[model samples]
Target: MTRVRVGCVHLLIAVSTVWVTQAQMGFVFPPVRIQAFSPRGIRVSVPDVEGITALLFDGNINKRIMYDKGDIHGFVTTKTNDYWVLDDPTVELHSGDVINYNVLLETGRFENSPILNGHFKSQQRHVVFNLERRSPPDSSLTVAESKNIKCNQSVTVVFNNNTPICSGQIIFEEDFGTLKEDVWQIEQYIPTEDPAYPFVSYQRSAVSVANMALHIAAKLQQTEPGFTSSSLYTFTLDLTDGCTGKMCKKQPSGADILPPVISGRITSKNFAFKYGTVIVRAKMPKGDWLYPEILLQPLIRNYGDTNYASGIINIASARGNEYLVANSKDYGRHVLYAGPIMDLKCREQLLQNKILVNKSWADNFHEYSLRWTPQYLTFSVDKEDWIHIEPGARGLVSRFPDNCTDLPRERLASSSELAPFDDLFHISLGLAVGGSTEFKDDLTTKADWPKPWRNSARKAMLNFWKDIDAWYPTWKQPELLIDYIKVIAL
Candidate 1:
């Protein structure tokens, strides 16, 4: 739990901010700003600080003071232990100026803090305080004179109909301590035998928020009142109340049956961003045919031909299979994949680089970062840039000339090389089970004890349910665990 506070002492102009994680003590955050002191001196009282004993600052080029153990060693006025006034005229701050400042908060426990500097010994200082600054805007212009004023110094980020913000500002953050419906909309529909994710039925019970994180677990379809995972018992699923898309009602046919597995998928309905850095810290799930996706989908798909025309950025993607030898290679948790998809035909061109890690990505939480800009898109794991894409002159379409032929030509409508992708995109997170298109039904993909389901067969779901004993035992804690998802302005 982090709580940051910014104090105001008569027109304190601060544009920069420093963040420090007090993993040890979690003391009340940080350097209490007390600038904007007049030459006559202003009494700045820092409240809410009970344990703080010493306060230090560079009074001027010739003077430095430290209030420690009730001993005032400065030229300023110290009425009480927590009360300080800058009576020194030489250290007065002006309206339009910049300065480097730090607040040493010695809580007695900062051995390896990121903000701690080497200048102070561990015994003397426990925390470091660095302040942010930028020249204040000119106040000479009146409301009549300021018309259509455009800010050029701030970073360009569009969201919530707000103006530009300072660089490195956290525009969006979800710690997943509690899953809020206002931020994420659950996908509740039975896409039985659909092209992309035709196997699983997304239900609310499969997902949960707990233990300071979002847990999206996959559950077996229980043979209940009206629905059954088996084909022998004919049943139907009528999800009319909370269905997200069409096909709310489905039943067992000659071959096509109800979804054998129940999983979860959530889309960010309230947030969308154009170009910025996205960081998703999550642990991949482990199970057969489990597809975990961290993606950025366009808010409005207005460029390409069909469904995936505008663009979709796959920040990070991986299968949950523990080990599966596909074409003499293991495309399991040990491998990591990242890339993009557009126009629905670029599966070969969809993936940029499939990285191989020392162990499984499902073993622990790893940071998946996407640095998106107008000119390029960079993907990184743990701050290590693994793959980056510099859009061609014809945009991403040029990368798939022969495959995605139906659309790419429409990219000429825009001047941006990253056309389609240049638009606003929303964050998406979820876990899908038993998809036909993602995992092929052939030896080339993975025989894995003769994959219970066949992609081409109409009774794919029914066939998979028949051999539940073979794969169901492998389903152990098969859920997507997300630490947090953060977005920073470029």
Candidate 2:
């Protein structure tokens, strides 16, 4: 063991073990895993870089890898929790360099990335490593050739496929080229008890991707493994494996029953952005009371107190019904809606958020776009203008109903004009059937086809299930088809 000085801290290097103590997570640095992605570029993946900042090579090279956003390549996206950081392997170690001191470690959230919570602060501790100087691959070799021959994970030597992909503006993109769990998290939750009170519960089997496009289809609940037509109403169902909804469980009563439909939802919970433009190509389903949720919901509810306080930007929303008439008006697929959902009443959301067309959206696929910035937001369908929302000088409060009130006015006062929207938001896709708040109770023509259930009725699910013959047969296309989704940072 040898003692050395780094900046102001004293460090002890265990020459034999080559170990460094990470006190925050209680991890002892042992045998660092190193890899070469390029001819000269090398990276080290540490299990947890909690309060650490940059890793140093021979005390001469310093590169910030823990929280790097300068270059897209620097921000390595990984499925594992280990932190992968690019180290400048191009620089060679000189004589008398302290091999044990590999980390230029810094502690405290204030000195680290802003995303971290500033609840703890610590002075730099003794972190040291001992290593024999290992040279990088010869700089003369081409990247492709270097990847195949020198690669340790044996198979066919392929030029480093682990290299970062940097395209302009695009931050998160999915062609459904195999649903990546690190990106699109397939939901395994159910809304059975106090569920959104929707007639459907999310199941994995209902979601699939074919021909490079994702399809979220709705199926009969009885088709699930252990469920049956009569058993659905008999046994109490709980989606406890990954229930994102309510935990309360209640036995099926006379009118109250299980979710009669099986549907699914997926979210990009692993990734989020502050301001970005999103484009989605999708075809709406042709069925009664089916609603497609293509939305960007807030990652943090920094504004108001309620669940939807941070706001939700609806990329595109269209009903499945093609010919449902309401009060001499057609509220079917002929109508498309897009807007920022601020509150549940959100008169601004309900009244002014709709766009009309002569043709039904379910007839063909449509390109839905959202251009969100710090100032204004524009929603478009098929590249045509749908709604352009640029709030007044005071912000969105002016557009909302008076009763909406100063919903946590204190926070909004100090925020940008796009308070709720300016914060980070992620993408979500799902299909829902027959919900209370979505459909108005008074209107919605079920008379012609015999609307079985009232939106406000306590026995709404039972009523809809009893008259399945009427609506189920009308489900010409019960799948919410998503061709592709892309999010580009502004």
Candidate 3:
């Protein structure tokens, strides 16, 4: 009788356990299916659901969520007494098959965030639902809208006739990554010394591309009695040895003479643009007697008897005596000159303007740009327009006397028609030292200069050269860091 009672008790316990399991099975929820995905967020659909009591989701989608002060937690929980908010959010859902919400958490607390387990209790059931996040499509990967386009990238410009101008895209760009030989031609030819200021020379070995930026440095070269600096020149393939064919070689000399200064220059002679915007980000070199120029040389050297204008867009002229006088107010040491030059023989400047910045140009990187159009040419520093030249502005004529016989017919007729600049032009970037005629004249007349330096500008340069070792260590730091040079057709 006792054994039979024990068997009956065991059977009753087993039956109760099965009944509890069956009741729990009725409360299970369906899995959440991913419908779509995007960079902004994801979409999901839940099936066979009536009313929801609690819904939880992972809020940390795009970025990591950290529990720190001032850190944004992009989630919130309502009905504070019923729901325990995890690091994620506990969402309360009404009866719906499809629900949409942003993946980003806009506002919430970061302290004691809860983990997402996809477990929730409904009005009629205790449920465990499977949630999935889909990956975004490949078409979603794209850059944001920018005014400046990358090299070789196409930009559509709509004309008045509704025709799209996409063919004249980015013509050239130099990021200084292992210098492309086909696009750039490094200059090796020696330049003739200017009679007014004859002191420095150009060298071929001074140009180099490293650390993803073009470095043009000036260093003292040991010479016979005095120290001189070398300079680098890019572009001007015509100035080089052979101009017979596309494949030209730079002239090599067996001369053992060492120049006092060594620098670097690079030019884009092969790539010329008619009307476009040219932008260059560069850091100027420090010290006295340094002239860093970003200019456009005309493709056609001469358009008649007169020499064609080489657009002097941006020039950081010598910070020596000329700058000292011009920039009397301690705004900046560097003197900025920008505009066009029509005749090289007379050296007349048309639409040129001078500006003084508030900081040393070598202290940080700044962008210098020139936007050339058929109507006008505008020059800017870091996108701030300091000089604007329209067609018929005063002093636009190439000749000053107004009765000069050598003035070009097109230029003489109307100053609005910008000659020499209308033709295609190539870009030139170079660093020159200690031979500016303007600076030389200032040193000769200025009484503010030091004793021996007041009369002789060359003597002051020599003094700086004597301490070259103390100034120039290597061509690495504080170089003319050319981040990039980009050209886009207007």
- Pairs clashing in candidate 1? none
The TM-score ranking, best first, is 1, 2, 3
Off-target runs (Cα >4 Å) in candidate 3 are 1-168, 193-198, 223-259, 304-312, 315-323, 326-332, 344-348, 351-358, 393-395, 398-416, 436-440, 444-447, 450-479
Instruction: Assess every candidate by TM-score.
Output: 0.67, 0.63, 0.53
Root-mean-square deviation (CA) per prediction? 13.7, 15.2, 21.6
State, as a TM-score between 0 and 1, how close model 2 is to the true structure: 0.63
Provide the clashing-pair count of each candidate structure. Answer: 0, 4, 23
> Per-residue lDDT of 134-226 in model 1, one digit per residue for the tens?
232221222432221212233435545343353554556667645777668887888643346556788877778886578888887664455
For model 3, state the Cα shift of residue 328 in Å: 4.3
lDDT of each: 0.60, 0.60, 0.44
**Model 3 accuracy (lDDT, Cα):** 0.44
Query: How far off is residue 81 in model 2, in Å?
Result: 35
Tens-digit lDDT track for model 2 on 137-163? 422333443343332321111111222
Candidate 1 matches the true fold with a TM-score of: 0.67
